[model samples]
Target: MFGNTLYVEKIQHALEQSNFPATPDNLYDPVRYMLSLSGKRIRPLLVLLGADLFNIENIDDALPASLAIEYFHNFSLVHDDIMDNAPLRRGKEAVHKKWNESVAILSGDALLVKAYEQLAFVKVEYIPELLRIFSQLAIEVCEGQQYDMDFESIDSITGDQYIEMIRLKTSVLLGGALEMGAIIANATLVDRKHINNFGVNLGIAFQLQDDILDVYGDPSTFGKQIAGDIIANKKTILYILLKSKLEQEDTQEFEDLLTNKAITSDEKITRMKNLYQKYHVVQEAGELKGKYTHLAYESLQKVNVTEPQKKELYSLADNLMRRTQ
Candidate 1:
């Protein structure tokens, strides 16, 4: 089986070769620009890896579906940046910032349409099931985004609600991508469900890792602005866990810090990090990430594939959890 490097290169080359119309520059340019940004491409990689797990001979058959997942992912990001009013994406100007919001919205809509267009090229036999999976994934992602926005307004949320939000907003696409590949490879229904479960659990772990990294990772390698979550007052696991552990006085103080407009962004980040350290939220977040990662491995173990066939996926999951970027 090909390793992750080869698969990533294949996906990159396919993206480079993707055809887009020239005349409608405003509508299509942001789509192209968004795709051009550097990303881990984890979701598309899941599709390819899922196919390989079943000993699919020509992994190229999975490319259209992979690209579909990618396009849809970028579409979400473009709109998400707008909603978050985030100025940067991948450390560059956001689509809404580089172009106008109108162009970004139209381009994002076009990317969703392009995702469906890529889905059309899947093997005829698999198209119907792929469509069904893709549609459900799309709706779930929207619902997850809505939940994320909703959380911003609510003062607090349970850890379970936070996990469910990330699972929907982020994890389901990973699960759906793997399921699509399994369908294309004609894997049995049981294997498909197991692999999807693996991806979902793994994706949750991945996002939790991200939540930690957002606060503590090296800005040069972490891709986006450091301490972004703290700056946005996002209700991350760290935030929730810290809040739960704080004394009554400290809880009120923490609320004051989050709403304090007088402090510099740097000051806010520093204070938040200090509070996180004091409360041991980072350590607790690491523990939670470990829990999900263990769950992912358990699911992966249930897949009906040979030990050798599972090596690459196991390696990929390890690398994902261990990644600094």
Candidate 2:
């Protein structure tokens, strides 16, 4: 029930309320702005939920590590937007859009460093695991970014590559976040691994759902334009899959749209979406998302969670998998 999740929600709300202006007045303010943006606070919520699963007293003891999770997530987003030249984040101006790339770059770096500063508050016993998980996630995120950039230049990409890219770029952090929470809660190793797998499969389902939404979500609810990925020629799950499946003329039209730098956002989005429909892109993406969702639920069922708790968690997973945007 929502009552059970209220505690995690409160921790997230408190974390946001505790925000303060960045120091030195001239620096790190941009990173601060990115942090201040109205993000869903999902990562921190995961931390609290992970801790609560083990009946950990005073989840606040995990607050610093939880904050680290958020800081690192925002830091990655700041740099990611710059690389993607994305103009908006959380439905507002992106950090790179608000400031010059140099400032954005420096501030993003500071955020990463500051993430470590807060992470130091993890009790001495948790330091090694924290460092190991953080380092591995950091590296994987970079690898994912590189793979994404690589996709821009390649003529074609495989479904496997697309899945791995999203796993690295988007899912690893989710897994790491829950694992970090388990580590802080001092859960059994089996439980920690299971929870981590839960996060991992959940992430795959979440990303695949996003891919499905990119072409089919309601425009108003989706925030961003539908089929925006197709317009950008981004190597999304749908795009790569459709590449090998669409008719030659259909493929050429999609490719031609991408080649045209002059196409309006609305026009490009419309054409790509129309073609996606003609080729059954949305259905294929939906099926892939379902596969991941089933896998995620299977992983969730393997944990020690009581049925009622499992229902609550399943509700969350259902929400993620079924989101419009």
Best by lDDT: 1
- Note the Cα lDDT for every prediction shown: 0.91, 0.78
Please give the distance, in angstroms, between residue 165's alpha carbon in candidate 1 and its true position after superposition: 0.5
- Residues 82-121, candidate 1: write the lDDT tens digits: 9999898998899999998999889999989999999899
Error of 1 at 125 (Å): 1.3
After aligning candidate 1 to the native by TM-score, how far in Å is the CA of 308 from where it should be? Answer: 1.1
Task: Score candidate 1 by lDDT.
Answer: 0.91
Minimal lDDT window, size 10, model 2:
1-10
Off by over 4 Å in 2: 1-5, 8-22, 247-251, 260-278
lDDT of candidate 2 over 1-325, digit per residue (tens): 3343675567566566645565754456786688778777788777767776666667777778788888888888989899989898888888877877877888888878877887788888988888898889889989998998888889778888888988898888888887887888888788888887888778987888777777777879877766777766777887788786878767677777778888887888778778777878778787887787787777777778676755656677777776765
TM-score, model 2 to reference: 0.89
Predicted candidate 1, C-alpha RMSD: 1.9
Candidate 1 off by > 4 Å: 218-225, 264-270
Which pairs in model 2 have colliding backbones?
none
